[model samples]
Target: MRMAARPLAWLLLLGILLVTVLPIEWRPVTGEPANLERLVAFALVGFVFVVGYPRHWWLVLGLVIAVALGFELAQLLAPSRHATLKDAVVKVAGGSLGVTAGVAANFLFTRLVPR
Candidate 1:
């Protein structure tokens, strides 16, 4: 599970970067609010990252936030996209929640499992 999650986490991050810097018209639509999409995307990535690399959870979290911020900043070069603090904040919040959940899960698993 951990082995699979590492690649999955990186793949998700790549997808996020592509979606973020693409032209607005080229972006996919889920009929959901854009902010929700961003939140969920970052959160899922964060959780998988922690699961894949369970050690140094704090570093994983910081890297997640950095990715969020870097992606948002990348928008400035997209011509059709713009960077905003509000969006960055939302991404960060989502990533934080995911990291917390992953850490808790790890904690519980270690406590309950004999090995």
Candidate 2:
């Protein structure tokens, strides 16, 4: 049987992108996190990315990095949004952690469930 389409995660990611690119005042309340928001966002994004595409974890990492940098570059256009090197570092770190967890989870699931 063919598997059903799973685009919800990607839609969520797009939403995240929208929120990320918006001005600070325009963005929704994602919690008290102010400086660490980038980290959290990338972590969640990386997690979902790996969960959605379990092949080539490193490629996912690259994509996460590219996305992070792309958003940072996009921020240059918004006077309210300023992308810093520190924020980029935090984003990469968070994504790495999330991707590592995802890889572990995928490995465990594959081991537990017969293909």
Candidate maximizing lDDT: 1
Cα lDDT tens digits for candidate 1, 1-115: 7899999999999999999999999999999999999999999998999999999789999999999999999999999999999999999988988888889888898899897
lDDT of 2 at 59: 90
How does candidate 2 score on lDDT?
0.75
Give the poorly placed runs of model 2, Cα more than 4 Å off: 1-6
Model 1 weakest 10-residue run by lDDT: 97-106
* Full-model lDDT for every candidate: 0.93, 0.75
State TM-scores per candidate: 0.95, 0.84
Per-residue accuracy of model 2 over 4-53 as CA lDDT, tens digit each = 11264466568767876888788987676755776777777777778778
Candidate 2, position 91, lDDT: 77
